[model samples]
Target: MILTRRALIAGSAAATGLVYAPALLGQGKPRVVVIGGGAGGATVARYLAKDAAGALDVTLVEAEPAYATCFFSNLYLGGLRDFDSLVHGYDRLAAGNVTVINDLATAVDREARRVTLAGGQVLDYDRLVLSPGIDFVEDSVPGWSLAAAETMPHAYKGGAQTELLKRMIQAMPQGGVFAMVAPPNPYRCPPAPYERVCMIAHLLNQTNPTAKIIILDPKEKFSKQALFEEGWGKYYNDMIQWINPEFGGADVAVRPDSMEVVIEGEVQKVDCCNVIPAQVAGGIAAQAGLTDETGWAPVHPDSMKSRIDGNIWILGDSSAQGDMPKSAFSANSQAKVAAMAIRGELIGSRVFPAKYSNSCWSLIAPEDGVKLGASYEPSGDRIASVDSFISDTGEDAALRKLTYEESFGWYAGITADIFG
Candidate 1:
């Protein structure tokens, strides 16, 4: 119920005064520099400080003082949750003795083992952990770029863009069309875009019943394909349409200025368009030179140590540790493993074999939630799924309601685990 981090910290230093200090490592503790404050970075920082009991200095460098989680942002768009509820501050983490630095990490000097911040601050670390989420891949979607985000809002990264998309959807004319250009594989949150479609449909069903929802997806198949399709048919009727590659979904272009989508040379005007282009490891990860040709940082299957650099570990969406979907749950799970490994190497704590797990839940209609999960272990050079489970199609109403409630519990529990 308390999630992995809290469950693991039962016997450790659970309460401690906050500390902010210079990034130098010679003050009787090995310093750790974490380059993102999302689920992975925050979890690892908290774990190291709590478990180490001041034996290590953990400094988390994140640009945002408060993080808006992309995990449940769809609920906000659907009017299921408030925007404030999705935003979390770093006060708890700062109170837990992890030095929180609000600055953009601009460069990583691997040979010198120092990080340079945009504010002209330098941080030195014995072990550097990069969890810098995802960045859009340039030219992945034709005629779409970061500059075009304002007109065609991706809304994939959470926060303002999400709010913008919700506003755009709300402003659509009656019986208008809502179009979503779903991302290809290896993007953050495999089922998120589809879940967004469901949430938007839920919103539109009440406000604009005649509003049609269209999905132009590049992938042939998606996560929870059967479950989503079942829920769509049952709740949305003829309100939603999905077009795959054979139907020009793969070849697409968008004109944000005109609010038009071109599919296989067929142009269509839409009231709202959500373009989720292809993505790569967040820019900072690639800046650190920890990423491979795949545009994601490669880590060892067991410890999450960067395959390119032994002194650095990568986590979450930035990491390409095979078989793990880039989700918050996977990041939290991987953070614990990395924290334990870092402690064992730096301060002589006991190290155990890495065991990881992740569960992703999506809401279709109200009280209709579906989930998929897997237990993983190191297999050869990758983290292989050992066991897995998913919600079955045509599950009873009570069971589906229970699954929805379970997701609520998981969100609260995981946020506490990551932030506190």
Candidate 2:
């Protein structure tokens, strides 16, 4: 059998004489395979490998050699942060005995308890944790597919497309229209599209005062509607425009090559367009047969264990946790609960109910930030919100600055929690 990337990493570790002890295999140690080393999977791997000590074998599979966080990506686009701030090193995870595999997962066989890599290698697992994150709903709009992403940068997942959008915005001529097509409900980062609009608008004001940005939102109300609208008014009053679902911004079709946004009955051609499509679980989760028609996997709330398979657990954007918005913070919070549950199960102990918390921050400007946060606990069959917080409308400058600082701190803490 061909060795997968993970097997190669493990083999390399063994070759380096990194304290390999096969004698420790049968001592209640359960092998756990994690798919997708993003916010959720990385955190789970770190915690499980560190806390479980020698009682758990942790392996992480990810196609990307390095991770670029979506959280502070807007700051990079806005020229407020550097690439170094958003990039993380996985040395801490390696130090915790977590084997990292840089490869794509092609298939997952639940019955055989094995994950197949694209290079035709199978990895068996005692417990499987999946946090592959979201995938675009290709058919959400006409003529919109992964190929379309090259021209009309979604920038939702914050990678190459993000830089593309920023470059396009910088090159746009004055008086040009920069259009943004927001996705429907239950998508990753509800405030993201709005935040992108704000950041782009900020740049436009400095370079091209006559340039306009139109937000075509499907939802009548957004995550932080009042605050975002207020920021737009205070910063760039006449330059920014928003059309809610009631006003024909709801239904949209895109032509990536032409850079046109069709809303209601009219097609509006623009210099730059961002179409953030509806999202579903990443491809690996769907291939594993863990997800249903809803594009998400149903899991036991307390344990994050898949309803379809006993030993498989799904986390982050792939798992359908009731009332949880698909945010990086939520993923980080869920990782802890899932790790604890897995630890409990491995020790033959009853897994207790889980609790989670999440806070999402949107930067409107260098000095302005808006946020919505909530804490929740498992209730009967769903996660119930216990308390919440939001940046108050019309706050003082000091408070706004405080919120901005808090947002930076959150980005640092969460990234550390995941990669460190």
Highest lDDT scorer? 1
Question: Highest TM-score: which candidate?
Answer: 1
Q: Taking the tens digit of each residue's C-alpha lDDT, what string does model 1 give over 213-281?
A: 999999899999999999999999789999999899999999999999999999999999999999999
Model 2, CA-based lDDT: 0.83
lDDT digits (tens) for residues 1-420 of candidate 2: 897645665764444323222223333468899998889999999988877766888888777767878877888777788766776756677776787766777888888899887655567899999999999999887778988888987887757777888899899998999988889888988888888778888888888889999988888788898898899899986788899988888778888888898888698889998888889998888898889999999888777888899998898888887888888998899999999989888855456668899999999888888789999988777777889999888999888888899998888778888988
Lowest-scoring 10 consecutive residues by lDDT in candidate 2?
A: 16-25
TM-score of each: 0.94, 0.93
Evaluate all candidate structures by whole-model CA lDDT and list the values in order: 0.91, 0.83
